[model samples]
Target: MKRSKKRIIKTIVFEILLIISSLLIFAPILLAIIMSIQPPEFVFSYPPKFLPRGFFVQNYIDAFKIVPFARMILNSALISIFITLGKLFTGSLSGYAYANFSFKGSKITFYVLFATLFIPAEIVLIVPLFRIISRLGWTNTYWAMTIPFLASATNTFLMQQHFKTIPKEFEDAARIDGATPMQYFTKVLLPLSRPIIAGAAIINFTYAWNMYLWPMIVAMEDRMKTVQVAINMIMNAESSNNWGIIMAATVVALLPTLILFFALQDLFVKSLVGSGVKG
Candidate 1:
């Protein structure tokens, strides 16, 4: 009875801590949103009010006028979707092969991929990458936005580890049913791998959406810029005091990722656990 009481108290304490921590983490985002809807006068008032005086949603309307907000958002979405799909498709296939099949030079190839794990993408052959993209006439184009970001070594490794947790019996059963390799992968493996797929998709989409420097370097055209880069441009173009509109733009930029996360939170959490699972 005493132990049960202690356990209850501990669980309650943990829940309280979680709530507090969540609120603390979310406070900044809340501030941005609240400030976004507030009048400029109240937003910059002395002592900086946490609660807005009133909701002035015109901030959002005004933000669109300041920049090509809609176009940039579309650009961000396009790049993120394509990159996420590419990563998931390639990651799963490479992972399945590494986890299930024994092939010549496969180990060596995998080890070479790990070399990227140590070297940061920022430092890895930027000059050559730019030159190649420029040569292909992909600079400032959708191809430039999507091509350089299609695959990730981290995604490959993660999918490989996640695939190892599945039973080989599933593969054997599919084979016994006369399924071709592609049919087995698509029909059997893909369906069962939803959790990891969701996780990878979310992660990759977020990464692609938030990319700043690469888009800035590659997409010189204002219409082709990603949301992050566009936001910076917006801020630079706006008067210093016009933060409300900027905040509103930020809120708009955050919607896709926020919606994606809330919608797929269960799968996202599962992906975290999936990463830790080994053969």
Candidate 2:
């Protein structure tokens, strides 16, 4: 009877802790939503009203007028799509080679790629990349932003780990059926590795979408500016400091990521767990 009572107490304590943790995690998002709907005049009011006295949806409309948000969204989307496809194709190919092939100095080559992960990207910002891009005449172009990060060591490592799990016999059987290397990879390996690829796609898309520093440096025109850089411009514009509109823009910025997460969150979690296990 005493042990049963203790078990019940433990369960209740765990449930209480879970609720508290969930609330803490969600508080900021909840606050953002509330602030986005609050009246512009009352944004900085004393004690900061948590609930609006009246409904006003004009903030979202004003945000669009203040900036060409639709154009910025389109630019960001195009860049992200190109970057995702580039990284997926190149990273997967390199990973497959590293996993299955045996060649002289292959280990050393992979080590060098892996070593890049340790080097802070900020440290290389001013020198070799600048010289190379300048020489190629890609400055102030989309290519400058999209081409450099087409393949990532982290993606390669993830794919390599996932690829290593497939039994060698699968490849051998494909070869026996007269399947070429490309055919084998496309049909056998890729199909089996969809989860890892999906995870990599999500990571690549988020990185490209939120990328600011590189785009700011490379894109010289207002039309070329990404969503992040444009958001900074919105903050600096001589508007009436309408917090509702600013918050609404922020909420707009967050929607794609939110939608992507909600749509693929289950797949994302499954991929991470499965990748770790396969590795």
Candidate 3:
């Protein structure tokens, strides 16, 4: 009876801790949503209002007017889509080669790619990357932003690990059917790797969408600037600093990622679990 009471007390403590942790994590997001609906005049009020007195949609409306939000959204969408696709294609190919095929210096190539993960973006920012992009005349272009990050070492590692979990018999069957290597990869392996691909896509999409520094550096023109850059401009605008508008814009920015995760969460979890099992 005493042991049962102790177990029950521990369970209650854990449940309370879990609830507190969740509240802590979600508090900022909840505050942002509330602030987004608040009137601009009351946004910076002291003793902070957790709930707005009245609903005002003008914060969102004003945000669009203050920034070329529509254009920025479109640009962000296009760039993110292309970057995610590029990462998926290139990373998967590299991963497949590493996981299935044996070739001269393959280990060395994999190590080089893995080494890039440790190199901070700041270290590569000033000289090699900028000069290479400048020499190619890619400055202020979409290619400058998209091409450089077309592949990711983490994605490649995830894909390779996932691929290893798949049975070799499938590849052998494809080979017996006289399928070429490319055909086998495209038709057989790619289909089976959907869960991992979806997980990678979510990660790449979020990274490309929220990326700030590189886009700011490469995209010089307002027309070329991404949504994140546009948001920074709005925040720094001299006319007025409307926290409500800023919060509204932030909520808008976060929606895509939230939606993407909700849609692919099951596949993402499955892929991560499968990768973890293999590792």
Candidate 4:
């Protein structure tokens, strides 16, 4: 009875701590939502209000008018979707090869790939990468944004480790059933890889959607800019003082990633646990 009481007390304390942490993390988002619906006067009021003064939605309407935000949204969506798909395709194939095939220099090749994880692309890769893109005449185009990110070493490593965890019996069973290697991979392996795939998709999508610096540099044309890059235009405009409009735009930018995360959070947790490196 004493132990049970202590356990209950501990659980209660932990729950309280979790609630506090959650509120701390969620406070900025709550403030953004409140500000987004408020009037400009309310935003600048002394002792800034934490709660909604009133739901004035003109801020959202004005966000679209202030910039070619709709076009920028379309550009980001297209680039993110294409990059995610491309990464999944390339990462999965490379991961499959590493996990299943044994050949000369296979270990050395995988080690080299693993070594790339430590290199920061923004610092080490950007200059050479931009030069190549420029030479290929891909600057200011979707091709430049999508192509450079089509393959992710991190995704490849995660997938390869996850693939290694699958039991050999599944492969043996597929072979005994007269399935070819490709058929077995598609039918057996991929079907079981949904958790990892979903996790990787969300990560890649969020990364591509949030890209600012590269898009800002490469896509110099206003029409070619991504949503993230275009947000700066809002900040530089005459009405930049309107925190409500800025907050509304910020919330709009966050929507896609937030929605995706909530939708697939379960699978994402499963992937985190299952994709851990294994011998």
Q: Count clashes in each candidate, considering only residues at least 3 apart in sequence or on different chains.
A: 0, 0, 0, 0
**Residue 60 C-alpha lDDT in model 1:** 93
Q: Write the per-residue lDDT of candidate 4 for residues 238-260, one digit (tens) a residue.
A: 99999888888899999999999
Runs of candidate 4 with Cα error greater than 4 angstroms are 276-279
Mark the 10 consecutive residues where model 4 has the least summed lDDT.
270-279
RMSD to the true structure for each prediction, in A, is 1.4, 2.4, 2.3, 1.5
lDDT ranking, best first: 4, 1, 3, 2
Candidate with the larger lDDT of 1 and 4? 4
Candidate 2 has what TM-score?
0.90
User: Taking the tens digit of each residue's C-alpha lDDT, what string does model 2 give over 23-136?
Assistant: 999887877777778776678888777776665788778777887887787778888889999999999999999999998999999999999899888566556887889899
lDDT of model 4 at residue 222?
87
| Local distance difference test values of all predictions, in order | 0.88, 0.84, 0.87, 0.91
Task: State every prediction's TM-score relative to the real structure.
Answer: 0.96, 0.90, 0.90, 0.96
Worst 10 residues of 1 by lDDT: 233-242
Give the Cα-based TM-score of candidate 3 against the true structure: 0.90
Per-residue lDDT tens digits of candidate 3, residues 38-81?
Answer: 98667778866687688889989988888788888888988999
